[model samples]
Target chain A: MNRLSFLAPVALIGALLLIWQGACSILHTPEYLLPAPTAIVLALILNAPILALSAWRTLAMALEALVAASVFAAVLALLVSLSRTLDRAIRPLAVALQVTPVVAIAPLVVIWAGVDHPDRAIVALAAIVAFFPIFSGAVRGLTSADLDLERLFDLYGARPWQRLLRLRLPSALPFIVEGAKVASGLAIIGAVVAEFVAGSGGAEGLAWRILEAGNRLRTAEMFAAILTLALMAAVVHLCFQALEKRALAWWRGR
Target chain B: MTDVVAALLAVEVDYPGRGKALGPFDLALVSGEIVALVGPSGCGKSTALRLLAGLEGPTRGTVRRAAGRGETSVVFQSPTLAPWLSATANVALPLELAGVAKAEARARAVEALARVGLGAAVNARPAQLSGGMAMRASLARALVTSPRLLLLDEPFAALDEITRRALADDLLAIWREARPAIVFVTHNVEEAVYMAGRVIVMTPGPGRSAGETRVEAPTPRPSGFRTTALFRDAAEAISDRLAAATRAAA
Candidate 1:
């Protein structure tokens, strides 16, 4: 049932794209205004080097931001959770960051961090945006443990570190995986949005390249870059999804 | 002539939100003795086992044991096996927790599994186990500790009659070998009569030992013991006492 349900969306997406191209052709839209799927494919193939290079830059920034955010969030959450008063203070702040629009503040983040190191600025913004879910997930996972199991460990006179390693961490793995899955996608989106708002000079991500292509009325080029971003997002998403499944296998086995 | 085996020197428990102390009273769970503590629900039978197992602290008083150096092990009513680990690992949990090396623990866990007649089930996870199988694994785990005291909290209450009898027999075999002072808790009078050398019936509220009955059946009590007149007499007596207590509680 699940396998069949999963395939339904792929079939639907193909049908939707076919209809979109058919409608555009029937309307006789110019290539500059609305490029057919073939035109976008041709542009992507021709400008593969430039587009791929720019995509690499954005991918690199997003990945760096993701690693930094996950590590920082996990560590900070661990430390903050140790103190109840501090957890209470930080939880609301973390939630506020999750709710606030990163898009709205992208230009300000670029201006304040200086446009020269826009990749760094974009990464920092992405880090802030990505950190919250990991922080929340890790904290929830760390805290939710069985009291009976805890007592059983205590009965054995087990050390705190032993209990944490054997029981608490295993229990929290699913939550950690869930947080990372959500964080990875957001990291890529954050980096791309920041690039669009800040506009890179030479080290621009594909987002800025797309804007440049659009401003010059290179619609097919714009579509090609958008296609690359979509592909990258899908790839990152699939990676995290696989990781989440593998990480939670033990829990699911139970 | 012999040293005191297991003694509760004025032990009492009080959890502020949950309930009150069960006893400041005295009792001895002597070596090689199976002392069944029978009581109604929420009468502190479970809590008493927890305290004896050192899973919880007594608000006041002390629980003393005969062993010079050995970990106490418990068999809970529900098999609280780690769902992730296989049955063998679940049975090996005490050894692992005691810092016995993994390969050694697993090897020893195999011996314990064989004793519980779960030799084929050692690799199966808790999810793959039936209620009876899970309980048997828990019994294996408790015995593997080689404790001076083996505390059981109605460990067989959930099993079917056939499996329950088989497990009871296995428990007795383990008890005979290990010779730990077994403090078994249950509400079943027949089980107490069949398993224990002595049965202590507790009064319902804030539970305490209401009466003690001795069962002087010989060693290695056989399968036929359950049908014997002596067993019937012991069970009937305990049942009458329990009925009176329940009536009083009501």
Candidate 2:
């Protein structure tokens, strides 16, 4: 936003980094236990190629999950909206799915999809965990339109598809965008958790990297992968913001 | 076929929410005439207009029409301009929905906007518009169809004195050019007198037609005639009739 606000987070982060380094240096802590900022930076740099490949793989999975989740959510939302009976029948099931821990089902998903393309099962798990909000938010938003606006369409003799395309969809975009913002982070979390289980439930993802680093006492390498996930989250958030602005620029400054 | 032109032969209204019968609304809405339905709030004045527009169904009795949808257009009290649409785009929606090409509909929308003194505000969205500008857009949308019947539900009730009078004048000019059967609703007695050839006083709740008073004003009625004895007389008479109707209903 403004200079002061921008500087605030950076200042806080710099202070935290300084504190971490100072605490480690004073305690004479071993590098493996609490790595210094410089050591973390060096570890990140040295493992660049392998880390980059893993980072790309994770990014691709997040994107794939996001797209699949959104499409599935939209179709389900539309279908539910079109039928009162179906909405009643499916709402409880949806609520249950939303509340159930994806971590609990990670083993089951791995067992079902198996290790042929283990990442595919992980991606599917990620999509399931992230899709509910988009569907529910979109359905609610589309139906929240002022009743008078709908009546006006009828008075003007607009047909069903025309009303949906011109009015309902546009009205739902903001809600859908908000849902996507929330799902972005969750999707990555889902993929990582699924990867963790697939190793136990029996393949590999960034979670494997975190486990490998932890076992080998490579804390900085673990932090590097963690940083990559954080960066991916930030990128996804930025992408949604840019897309929302592009779609709704006409409503800018409202 | 009965050629009883310029009539609403015992129209009635109902809805699930508004459970009871609204009105057995009888009126002699003549051609080339302006009638004002004056009543308290929720008195079925707008409901009568809705029935006439065929937007709502009557529980009993008929809302007789001379012809189908092409014969009428309605202007709601709240402007009702589509918020997501620009002024020209909102006005053009009706024509476009009626199978007109986008360009032709927009052209007519522009012309209607000019008539309502909003020529320069074509690209402005409803959110950017003042109440008067948005109302003008609503009126423009109604007029663009060139219908034989115009249903206005307290169209100027939300405006200040200056804008209301300006809109009244603009509407009268448009009426003269188009010569539609206009049914204007209002709570303001003076406004009813200012705008209409006939003022129909209505009962307050569970409404019915109280009485109708005919004004002998000249065609394309003078906007300044609001200061004249005729206007005062009409307003006072309508007020008396409204009071009487409310008393009778009570």
Candidate 3:
């Protein structure tokens, strides 16, 4: 049953792609309106070098931003967990940052960092987009330790730092991993959106390539770029899923 | 005179908005003695144990402990083992917290697990253990430190009858071996009488000590002791006091 469930998604995706190709051929759909799967694949092969480079840059920016955001979130969560007053003071600001549209802020970040270091603006913006899930996850994780366990630690005379490291941190791992999975995808989106708005001159990220392809009326290449972004997001999601499985191997059930 | 491990002298505990929770209670635990606090729910049995464990402070009066911070331990009602850690690691936590080296702590933890008959399940997580095994692991963790004072808050109340009896026997054996001053809290009249040398009955609400019963049933209580007439009589007497205390509180 489990094996069949795993195969179902792969089978469904393949069937959808076949139907899409068949419809495109039968309807004589214009390539500009909807490129056939073959055309997109061909474009991907033909433009592999540039596409790969652009994909690499975007993935790198996303990854760097994810790492930075994780550290910031962990430290901030620790501070918030340590003091209720700080949590009350700073939590609303974090929520505000999370709710604001990243697209609106990308242009300002680009201007602030200047064109010489557009990468800085991209990283900053992506980090901003990625920060909240991890922060919220970690805060909830750190503070949600069982009251009995906390009292047990107290009775054992665990020092403050010992309690944080041994009990609180381990208890929070599953929550942190869950949050990171959500944040990883957002980090990529943030990177692409920032690139689209800021124009990554020499860097030429996948988002910029998409803009260039669209301007030149290369619809196949545009679709190819979108495909790469989807693939990157899938790979990021899968990696975190692996991490969650490995870290929480002890957890019972789903 | 035996050493007094801990004492609550006319101690009362009050929650800020919830009025008085427990007390004007007086109790003293001496070295190598097994004491049980028994009453109905909301009777502050746990509150008294917490006070002795130094987990909470008395609102009025004082609580005194001869055992220092690292010399005391508690086992809660549920198996409070860290779900993420293996049984061995959970047992090792107290020593690790007290600045013991990792290697030494693990060595001692293995010994503790073995003492509780969990030697074969050392690598298993709490989630992997049955209710009986998990509670055994919790007991190992509490006993790992060889604490001078051990406070147990209804540790076996959640187990089934067979597991509860088995665990009760295991606890008696462990207590006999270690001889720590123990304050066990439970609502089970039979368990209270079987495990404790002295059972202190408490009123139902805003709890206070009602009376004490001395169990003259002898130590190293045999496995079949629970069904014995002497055990039944002791349990019956404590149950009668418990009933009166509940009625008075009502």
Candidate 4:
């Protein structure tokens, strides 16, 4: 059953690509409009080194931003769980950050961080976009500590720190992993969008490569770059899924 | 008689908006004695257990514990095992919290699990265990600390009849060996009489102790004792008190 489910998507993608290639050839389609999969594949082979470098840069930035967001979210969640006052004070600010689109704020972030540190600005933007899900997940997990377990801890006279470490943190892990799966994808998006606003000059991120290709009317190259970005996002998501399975092995039993 | 392990002196609990939840009553638990609190659903049997465990403060009066905080343990209605942790790790949690070295705590946890007949399942997480096994793991956790006083709130209420009887027998064996003062809360009159030396009946709603019955059944209560006439008589007497208490409350 699992093998059939896995093969189904691969088969569908192959059939769609075959049709796209056939249609493009029979119609004598212009290359600048919608390049055939073959043309995109050719572009990918020709610019393999540069595209690989750009993909790596984008992946690095997204990963860094995700790590920073997770750490910041965890610490914030710990504080929020520690006190009701902190939760009341910080929850609105977090909500505001979440609702505010990263695209709308990216330009301002780049300008504020100054021209010398475009990478920092992009990383910061991605971190902001990725922060809320992890924070909310951690808070929910922490607060959901079992009442019966808490009472047992009370009976044993567990210290506050002990309770936080032994009970609350372990409970929060699956939730944090859940949030991370979502935030990992968002982090890549934030990085790509921020790169778009910042322009392609320094460090030529994948997003910048796409914009450069578009301006030069290198449509096949643009398609190739977009494909690279999609692959990067898929890889990031798959990595997180693997991590979730490992971390929650006790819950999933596999 | 042994010294008093704990006492509730004219204790009553009132929720801010929910009125009186329990008491304006008193009781004492003697060292090495097993006491059961039994009543209808709405009665504050659990509330009384919470007071004894020091999980909640009485609204009106004092609850005094002769045993120190570390000398008390509680088993709640659910097993409450941490899903991520192995049975040994779950059982070792109290010792770990108290700063015992990891190896030492784990060794003690293994010993406790063995006592509950869960020696082979020590590495299993809660999800991997059957209902009876999970409850045994929970019981192991409670006994691991060798507490001077143990508070249990309907610990067997969720189990099948066979599992419940087996666990009750296991609990009796552990109690005999360890001799902790125990306050067991349950709605099962048979269970109350089967496990406890004294059964304290409670009135319904704004609960307080209505009456007490001493079980004359011999110690190390024989296997198949549940079918015996003596056990039935004790259960009947406690049931009568419980029925009267319910009627009086109405």
Candidate 5:
């Protein structure tokens, strides 16, 4: 049953790709407009080296952004948990940043991060996009410790740091893992959208490749790049899912 | 004179939004004695336990707890073990929090777990344990520190009768070894009479002490003591007081 469940999605995707390829051929569609699955595969093989480099660049940016966002959010969440004043001060700003579209802010971020390092700007924008989930999830997780356990800790006269390390942080693990899963997807998207906003200014991620391909009507290459992005996102998601399973075995056992 | 481990002096707690939850109540726990607080739901019995554990302050009176760091331990109705940790690790936490070395704490935790009949399940996560086993782990965690004040808020209320009876006996055994001033809150009159020497019955919400029954049985009473006339009489007396308190409130 488990094997069949796993095979179902693969089978569905294979069928869809076959249908798409057949439709393009039957309609005599132009390759530059709507590239067939076969044409995209050919483009992928033809441009493997360039596509691989660009894919790596994009993946690296997303990963770097994810790490930065996770660290910053964790520290900030810790501060918020420690101090009511900090929580009151930072929460509104976090919400405001979250509510404002990342696209609208990308241009300003790119310029401020400096035109010379579009890579840095893309990473920064991605980090911003990835920040809120980790921050909010961590905040909720840290503060949402079991009340009975809180009293137990108090009875022991546990130091603040001890409570955090032993109780709050362990309780927060499932939540932080969940936030990271959501943030991983957003980081990829933010990097791509920031690449678009960064324009053709030497930023060399997969999104840049897509833009370059589209301008030259290399639609097959564009499709190939999109497929690569999807694969990367799926892989990243799976990594976090595996982590949640391995590190939080006890949580699921409950 | 008995060594007074802690006292609640005219402690009245008025929870914000829920006025007059407990007391002007008074309680004095003597060292190495087991007392049970029994009352109906919303009788502020838990509030009184919190007061003794130093988890909450009185709104209008004083709570005196002499216990310092790692000197008080509490077990709630649920096991309240950290699900991420192994049973040994959970038991070791209070000692670790008190700056004990990890090796020493873990070794001591294993010993404590063994005392509570959880030696075989030391590495099990809380989620993996049956309710009875989980509560035993909780007992180990509570006793690992050898606390002067051991507070239990219905620690075995969720267990089946057999498990509950077994735990009650095991707890008494551990108490014999290291006699902390045990104060547990429960709604069960028979359990109160069985486990504690003195059972203090409280009035309904905004509770004050309604009555007290002293069970004349030895510490770690002999097997089948629960069926004895002494236990029966004490249980009935407390049950009558609880019923009267509930009736008066209505």
Candidate 6:
């Protein structure tokens, strides 16, 4: 990005924060109603230990969910690509899982996995939420090889595995990268939503901290937890974006 | 006849919904000969090339092939290089796929790239090369295996005039080495005349052979061959056949 574009968001957010802080002080609004940015920062500092631990847990779960989703999606995508019957058989079920809201299923998952370790349940729910994009992306990538290349492979008498390895998989790499980026964000959202659904189930994640702080009307801490989650999501996105640049260096500048 | 490389004996392809897409057509490739198929769009020139490439089967007739594994290679209209791979790697692919060791394949690939005048761009990705260079890399890949038969389907059509002419000449220069029987397909009448010993004209879709013209000029003609009366007469004969076919279809 250019310098001006990069600075634009920083400038806009700075102005908005100034206005927010000014409005809070001018109106003498209670912290519980809408915590000022300064108050939120202070709360973030004061609860750094608890907040860091919770954030770490949430981030770990999201990462685990992403890896799990990637593996499952890749295997399923390969199976679907291999057989028309398998694709027809599995597609509707995958679509059903995708369309069903994670929030709707989070409670059942938490109860089923046994509330003794709600973290595991949250990760499972998050994986489910993150699964479809990677799966569909993988399926598209596996089949996205150039038609002429397919003909070339056939002419060379490429074995099935050889075709998959040399042509189909490499062709799908960009798609998988994009799908993983989307899945990373969804995985975080899924983790947080699952945490919210499993409130006070002894899960220590940023979402749980938010729920706990809100119960005592510590709105600043709640906002602080949310800010931390937002930061985490942004970092995850930046990581994936960097990865895309590195992994798909050949694909870029085309 | 004993040196016949391959032939389409009354070959026909019928798509499920589209009915006959190609012949009831016949073509035979003799060893070390260059033949071009020229016709209107959708006249099954490409289909004919595909049949020769063994990429498609004839629904109604037999395809006879004497050439065996790695004995045939094709270059399509687009360069169609694997965008993710370096030019050398892309050229090396057919060899590697055919079970040649990676090191040997790569070494030969570099030789092939140099042969096509892309030696400096061996490490460049397909996206990094110019349009003509990419197509040259594709040509190198096709020649890497030294197939007995080379099938080209409108290989230079996407290129500008200068690049097209340069590639056509480069192809001829390379073809002299292996002397593969080449079946070239194109819509460009002059290109068909310039590149092939025989130019076959086809009627419009579900195409049958309209006629064929034999160019008596030698392979890789001298400079200014394009302006020569011999080239003009041969091109005109093919064009006349093409116009007649188009008019008949109309």
lDDT digits (tens) for residues B18-52 of candidate 2: 66556677876666678888988878877777777
Interface root mean square deviation per prediction: 2.3, 2.4, 2.5, 1.9, 2.0, 1.8
Which ranges of candidate 5 are over 4 A from the true structure?
A1-11, A250-254, B66-69
Ordering by lDDT: 6, 5, 4, 3, 1, 2
Ranking by DockQ: 6, 5, 4, 3, 2, 1
> How much is the lDDT of residue B82 in candidate 5?
83
**Candidate 5: TM-score?**
0.94
| Model 6: per-residue Cα lDDT over B94-207, one tens digit each | 999999999999999999999999999989999889999999999999999999999999999999999999999999998888899999999899999899999999999998
TM-scores, all candidates, are 0.85, 0.90, 0.92, 0.94, 0.94, 0.97
Q: What is the DockQ of candidate 5?
A: 0.64
- Report lDDT (CA) for all predictions: 0.82, 0.80, 0.90, 0.90, 0.91, 0.93
The chain A TM-scores for the candidates, taken one by one, are 0.89, 0.91, 0.92, 0.95, 0.94, 0.96
Share of true Cα-Cα contacts across chains kept by each model = 0.33, 0.26, 0.70, 0.65, 0.70, 0.77
* Model 3 chain A poorest ten-residue lDDT run: A245-254
Count of backbone collisions in candidate 3: 0
| CA lDDT for candidate 1 | 0.82
A30 Cα displacement, candidate 3 (Å) = 2.7
Query: Which model is ahead, 4 or 6, in terms of DockQ?
Result: 6
Candidate 1 residue runs with Cα over 4 Å from true position: A1-11, A29-49, A80-93, A104-108, A201-203, A250-254, B1-3, B9-11, B19-26, B66-69, B83-93, B96-103, B120-131, B203-205
Report the lDDT tens digits of candidate 5 across residue range A1-254: 99999999999999999999999999989999898998999998998898889989999999999999999999999999999999999999999999999999999998999888999999999999999999999999999999888888887778888899988998898888889989999999999999999996477999998899999999999998888888888998899888878767767455
Model 6, first chain, TM-score of: 0.96
Worst 10 residues of 2 chain A by lDDT: A199-208
Model 6 docking grade: medium
Candidate 6 Cα lDDT to native: 0.93
Model 4 Cα shift for residue B91 (angstroms): 2.3
- The number of the candidate with the highest DockQ is 6
